[model samples]
Target: MIRYISLQNCPFDPGEELCKFRSESIGAIASFTGLVRSENEIVALSIEHHPVMTQKTLEQLCDMVITRYHLLGVSITHRYELLKLGEPIVFVAAASVHRKAAMEAIVYMMDRLKTDIPLWKKEIFADGTSRWIEQKQSDVDRSFSW
Candidate 1:
């Protein structure tokens, strides 16, 4: 089994990361890339985190998904610090022998990541106003579904 987790301040290439995550024995791979949206005239996103706790939480989440889905490989990458609109914020991928497991695992991982992680986000608008984002009930509901 292969498991990779990273929390960085720099931007990453999802395609390159996907290629690195590929395994010969894996028959299916499911991936997700989350980007900063241009909603509400948002100019940038500032992500903050407790470095140690954030990494630990992500690792634990990845391990749980790998075991629950019987995955052969898993990878998650998340970025902190300020990010411009439309920049990638996160990447998640799962590999398994069957397509269904991989797909479900990806969804589960993403849902968990949205709610379980220690990172916080602040949306900076074009008008020089910014606000810290709060977790949505919808995200909590989605994570609870699994």
Candidate 2:
């Protein structure tokens, strides 16, 4: 499996990264992009992560999904620091010989990352207030249900 995992402080283009996957043996590539929203009076978001710990955790999760799905390639990029509304926060992808495998790998990795990763996010409101985003019940249930 070809896998790339990164936790960085800069913004990234999910579409560009998704276009980078190319393999004649792989039939499909599934991808997902997470973004900072403009809803709920949110102006921006601030993400905080311990670089070393976050990278290690992401790598382990990616490896698990890639191996389990026999993916030809996978790439996951998560961003920290300040992000404005509609900015891309994460880019996830999985390439495999079958569409099901590629789709499942991306979904599983994203679910686990949403519920299990240690990164923290503070949503900055338009009213000059900020609050930490808590884990969602749906995310937890989805991750544990497998």
TM-score for candidate 2? 0.95
Off by over 4 Å in 2: none
Query: How many clashes (backbone N, Cα, C below 3 Å) per candidate?
Result: 0, 0
Q: Judging by lDDT against the true structure, name the best candidate.
A: 1
Local error of candidate 2 at 107, Å?
0.9
Q: 1-146, model 1: which lDDT tens digit per residue?
A: 88989888998999988887656899999999999999878899999998789999999998899999999999999999999988899999999998999999999999998899999999998889899999999999998988
Candidate 2: Cα lDDT at 72: 93
Candidate lDDT values, in order: 0.92, 0.88
Q: Stretches of candidate 1 above 4 Å error?
A: none
| Residues 1-146, model 2: lDDT tens digits | 56788787888888789877877898999999999978778999999987677888898888888789999999999989999889899999999999999999988989988877789999999779999998899989999998
TM-score, model 1 to reference: 0.96
